[model samples]
Target: MTTLILMVAGGLLGWSAYHKIPEAFAVAIAAAIMVLPVYLVASGEGRTQAEEDPAKEDPAQVLRRRVQAVNQAFTEAVALMDLLRRDLDAQQAAREALLAEAERQQRLLELNEEEAEKIRQILIGETKASIRAGRRRELRFFLAGILLSAALSIPIGIWVNSIS
Candidate 1:
C-alpha cells in the first residue's frame, strides 16, 4: 500500500516538474518507472530487490559472482559446440567411406563381367573341339564297316561263280 502511494506521488511529481522536457517523454518515463517493479515481480524474472541491493555483500563480490556464472555458461556452450562439430565430421567421414565402398563394389562388378566373358569364350572353344572329335570317330567307324563288307562280298562272289 505504501509502495503504491510512493509510485503515484513520484509519477505526479515527474509530470509537473519536467517543464523543459517534452510532455510525452516525461509522462512515459514516469509511467515506466512506476510499473517496472510490478512487472518484474509478476514475471518472476530479473534480479530481485535483495539481489540488486548490494547491501549484504560487497559490490565487487557480486560482480565477480555474476562474471563467473557467465564464464561457466560460456565454457559449457563452447564444449557442446565442439562436440557437435566432431559428430558432424564423423558423419561426413562415414558417408565418404560408404560411397567409396560402393565404388569398389562397382569395380568388382565390372571385373566379374569381364571374367564371365572370358569363361564363355573358353567354353565355346571346348565345345567346338568336342564336336570335331566326335565327327572324327564317326568317320573312322564308317570306313571300317565299308572295308569289312567288301572283303566278305569278294569271297562270297568267288564261291557263287564257281558253283554256277
Candidate 2:
C-alpha cells in the first residue's frame, strides 16, 4: 500500500512538471527524477523480501525502509507544488501583458476620436465662412442692379418730358 502511494505521488509529480516545462527533454528529466526513487523503493522491497524470511527480518531494516519511503513521498510532493507555482506565475505574467496591450489600444482609439472631432469642427467652420461670403456677394450684386436701373430711368424720363 505504501509503494502504491509512492507510485501515485511520483506520477503526479511527473505530470505536473510535464505541464510546466515545455521541452520534451526537460519533461523526461523530471519524469526520471520522479521515477527513480519509486523504482528504488520498489526494487529494494522485492530484494529484501526475496533475500530474507519474513519471520527473521530485522526490525531496524524495516524501520529504515519505512523512513526512506516517507522521505521520498515528501520530496515528490514538494516538487509537484513547485511546478504548480511556476505555472501560476507564468499565467499571471501573460494576463498582465494582455491587459497592458488592451490599455494601449484603448488610448490610441481615444486619441483618434479626438483628432477626428477637431477635423470635423474645422470643416464646419470653413463651410459657414463660405456661406457668409456667398451671401455678401449676392447682396452687393442686388444693390448694383438697383442703382443702375434708377440712374437710367431718370435720364430717359427727363428726355421724354422735354420732347413733349
Candidate 3:
C-alpha cells in the first residue's frame, strides 16, 4: 500500500514538473521523482513486508534453500531428458516400420510386373498358334478342291470316248 501510494505521488509530481519547467530540467525532475519512491522502498527506509517480520535469515538456511532449488531444477531436467529419449526411441521404431513396409510394397510391385510379363508371353504364343492353324486349314481346303475336280473330269473323259 505504501509503494502504491509512493508510485502514484511520484507520477503526479513528474507530470506537473514536465509541464512547468524547461525541457531538460523537466526531464531530470520527472526522472528523479519517479526513481525516488522506488529507491526509498528498495532501501527499506519505509515500513515494508520484510521490516514487519524483522527475522534475520542465517547463512545456513539460505544455503539450504538454494540447494533445494538446485536439486529440484536438476530433477526436472533429468525427467525432461528421459522424456526426450523415449520420444526419440518411438520415432526410430516408427521409421523402421515405415521402411519395412516400403520394402514389402516394392517386392510386391516387382512380383506383379513379373506376373504381367508372363501373361503377355502366354497371349503372344496363343496368337501365333491360332495364325498357324488358320493357314493349315486354308491349305487343306485348296487340296480338296483340286482332288474333286480331277475325280469328276476323269469319268466324263471316258464316257466321251465310248460314245465316239
Candidate 4:
C-alpha cells in the first residue's frame, strides 16, 4: 500500500523534474513507450484481487513473510540432510566392523579345517597299521580268494557275452 504509493509518487516527481528540463519530455516519452506495456503486463490486468481487497495490498509485508517461510523450510531441509548423512556414516562404520568380524571368523574356520585334516591323517595312519596287523597271517588265504574270484568273474563275463 504505502510502497506502491511511494513508487508512483517518485515516478511522477521524477517525470515532473524531467519535464522542467529542456526537451527531456521527448526522452521520457520514448522511455515510457518502451516500458509502459511491460509494467502493465507485470502488474497484471486492470485491478488485482489484492487491489480489490485492501487487506492484501501490503505486498512488501507479503514478500517478507514468504522470505521467512522459505528460509525456515530451507533450514529444516538442511537439517534433515545432515541427519541422513550422519546415519549413513554410522551404517558404513557398522558394515566395516561386520566385514572385519566375518574375516576373523573365516580365518578361524580355515584353522579348524587344517586341524581336522591333521587329525584325519593320524586316524588314517592308525587304520592302515590295524589292517596290516589283522591281516598278517591271511596273505595265502587272500591270494587263493583272489584267484577263485577271478575264475568265477571270467565265466560270468563269457555267459553275458553269449546272451547279448
Instruction: Give each model a TM-score.
Output: 0.53, 0.60, 0.58, 0.44
Worst 10-residue lDDT window, candidate 2:
1-10
* Model 2 per-residue lDDT tens digits across residues 1-164: 44454455445545655577544455455555555656666566445553366567676876686677768765774666466447546756886999999999999999999999999999999999999999999999999999999999999999999999
User: What does candidate 3's lDDT look like per residue over 59-117, in tens digits?
Assistant: 57655655665565455444443443454467558869999999999999999999999
Segments of candidate 3 deviating more than 4 angstroms: 1-55, 153-164
lDDT score, residue 55, model 3? Answer: 64
- C-alpha displacement of 76 in model 1, angstroms? 1.8
Q: What are the clashing pairs of model 3?
A: none
Q: Could you tell me the TM-score of candidate 2?
A: 0.60
lDDT of 1: 0.65
Name the better of 2 and 3 by lDDT.
2
What ordering of candidates by TM-score runs from best to worst?
2, 3, 1, 4
Best by lDDT: 2
Question: Each candidate's lDDT (Cα)?
Answer: 0.65, 0.68, 0.61, 0.61
Q: Lowest-lDDT window of 10 residues in candidate 1?
A: 76-85
Native RMSD of candidate 2 (Å): 8.5
Which stretches of model 4 miss by more than 4 angstroms?
1-57, 129-164
Clashing pairs in model 4? Answer: none
